[model samples]
Target: MAKRRTTPKELPDAVREAVDRTVQATRGSAVQTRERAQGAVDDLVDTVDDLVKGAEGRIVRGRRAAARAIDDVRPATNEDMRELKAELRRIGRRLEAIEERLPAKRPPTTRQGAKSGSGSAKPRAARSGSSAKPRSAKRGSSAG
Candidate 1:
């Protein structure tokens, strides 16, 4: 029985072929891994987008509900204030028109140092000659 021996040139060629086969397998595996990673990243992005949309919807609904609650608690609306203001303006105009049609009366005048025939009663403080301040002066001093 004769055993076949490998030549020197054949050994190097076999090693090169094995290395090439390993590189090709590694490249194929790398491409598959990259594709799977990209798919996972796309799914994550989609899920995040859906979550953001849901959150936005909830926020809008909450804002609308808050506005409704505020409206329920408020005393009057903008429209009501506008109507009241318009009614007041109409009444003021009517009063002015009525005043223009009526006759004007002169205010009564009193002569200085002339005693009128009206009530001659004096205040108790003035009759007693007390040094206490008058009610009007006290009110004026306190208000300031």
Candidate 2:
């Protein structure tokens, strides 16, 4: 007896059509997802651009305000400084005039020994322990 070869089976038409539909649906979903993602990225980019422009505008405004503030303050501060300098100079001149009018400082007075032509005064001796003499109540009678 000779052996026979068997042929491979093909999928049914309905099953093949179902698989084809599923593939087409998946491809459509992928394209839609890509388009949505691109739109979100563009929107994000636009939002960032708006934020940057807003920040730039605020910075410009702030800089202008600061410049205006400095301008407003500069003259007043300069005038105040000038007045302070003038006042200081006037005070210095007044002090100089007072100093010139004041009496000159005198030399310190000499010690008694130096004035009397004596040698340096000697220190007193320490007293010995002794019974003190009684004091009289009437001062003039004691002196007499």
Q: Which structure among the candidates has the greatest lDDT?
A: 1
Each candidate's clash count: 0, 0
**Which residue segments of model 2 deviate by more than 4 Å?**
1-11, 75-144
Model 2: residue 40 alpha-carbon error in angstroms: 1.4
What Cα-based lDDT does every candidate model obtain?
Answer: 0.86, 0.77
Candidate 2 residue lDDT tens string, 1-144: 898866445546677899999999999999999999999999999999999999999999999999999988876677888999999979967876887799986764666556574533432232444444422333345543
Candidate No. with top TM-score: 1
Residue 140 in model 2: lDDT: 44
Mind giving the per-residue lDDT tens digits that candidate 1 earns over 7-70? 8888988999999999999999999999999999999999999999999999999999999999
Q: Give candidate 1 regions above 4 Å deviation.
A: 1-7, 77-144
Go through the candidates in order and give the C-alpha RMSD of each one to the true structure: 17.4, 23.3
